[model samples]
Target: MPVPATGRLQWTDVPTPLRARLEDALDAPVTDTNTPAGGFGHQLAAALTLRGGRRVFVKAAPDADPLTAANVHEAAVLQALPPGAPAPSLLGVHRASRWTAVVIAHLDGPHPDLSPASTDAEQTWALLDKLTSSPAPAPYRAAVSATPSTAASLHGWAELAADPPADLPAAARDRLQQLAELETAWPALACGDRIVHGDLRADNMVRDHHHGVTFVDWAHATTGPACIDAASLAPQLVLAGHTPEDVADLLRDHPATATSPETTTAFLTALTGHWHRNARKPAPPGAPGLRAYQHRAAAAGLALLSHRLS
Candidate 1:
């Protein structure tokens, strides 16, 4: 994943009143804070060291910020995760001085290396298995409909085909109509009730040496086909230096992707279209590197989709 261009806010940058309120809510005094790099947004994500030597992960954003809602949603999803789910436990959600914060158990580890020959890939599969093994909780099923939430974003191929962009990649231009058709197949094929980490990627997972892989970032969690999470990993695997064909073969044999090959093809095509179209737009308000990252990811997705199409 590309390092976010806009640097994250330091803990000290958080308003004093808000920080005080956060500490009060946690019932602990903050002694120190550490902010890590490499995320997609410009949110305040830090690990706080409490007075009693306890550590917790906190992510906060202004009420007006888009991420504020996401933080709130994440807190709810984490709270609703069933027992034994490979995810962090939600500690609390604090809102003060027009800022929103979601705190969770601190997970100490680095993002998994998804390159070929790495055990991290297998660990990710294991996590996916455990995650989808059970039905989505009642709260999530009532609050989120996975297919409709993402269908609009994934329909970009149809729009691009109608009025192709000048900077559209050569490979996509040659098969624009075919891709447009394939992109429409996901809605029908993605019907299921399993909870999926809708945005599964290397950066969204942390590999704890002792505990294996732990999934993070539940903001995009949704109820969909068992394969959604596994399909989301294909482009990332390609980005990690595996050939598109190899990623396809690996996913084909995985239990999560037990659906027809067409399902994976359509999902990847729609996903590629989303990135390709979005990458050409202006950068988002707080994420300068987002479009550039999308451009690179779109290339990877296109390569993966092309192989599947052939």
Candidate 2:
């Protein structure tokens, strides 16, 4: 198994019989396997060479757990997409007692290494337009509805403010308090019933030579306000060198990006505050990236708050 630097379990050689089954199911021989960079998800893709020197990328999630439902929902989301949508096509799904796997048509594109100059922001807006405009299919909606809401999320702002983490810096702590105030004031923000990517960081996007943009990692797909997806991207956008002003401008210009500036600001602030609180704690076994994520989240929160206050 390729152990991740964070000590996460990663891809390893598949048992011979399982590998043969996968090859047969994919209708191609796996030639070269390469570990792609991404989160803690148990997924891997390989380049396959077919008869005429043609190549395709084959991705599999053999270790999908209860999260398999999310993958299944993603397949349904892909199935419901309109023509020319920038995401990959769902190829196949195989399920067994202990695991589930999904195969997708290969997308050949550069990982959208987001930069101030990169077209990621523009492309992401276009993709959001497509996703929010279309209604989520039944299965996807059901899957989202079935998932349990986190207690922190359901408790709303007052509770969050009253219980701010003690370890955060004073500045970050103050910002979190402000976030609670804003969330309380703007408690009635509209949440649309549309299919949201739910996690729209640059890492999940690719810019192919043929396909201008393609999104992956659909495990977070949900039927919620597109604002949540936008909020999810806010931290990553900051990490990618976009200024808070840039992000705010995008949100203001794109109606589907967020419900309102205050709502977006509150969401980003709360998200970062949560991360900062968690990161101050001792690192969990096998989760070194948590600290890095915390720092990034804090930076994102502060940047957004600074812009909003200014």
lDDT, each prediction: 0.80, 0.62
Clashes of 2: 1
Best-matching candidate per TM-score: 1
Q: Which residues of candidate 1, in runs, are more than 4 Å off?
A: 1-5, 143-148
Error of 1 at 68 (Å): 1.2
- Residue-level lDDT for 71 in candidate 1: 81
Across 1-310, the per-residue lDDT of candidate 2 in tens digits comes to 3323453332244445656666677676666554556554544445455555555544444453444566766776666555666678888776544455566676676688667887767777777777776666676566566553231252233554667656546665665556667655433553557776756776677777787778876766656555666666666778888887887677667766545566666565556655655666676554457677767767786677677666
- Which residue pairs clash within candidate 2? 109-208
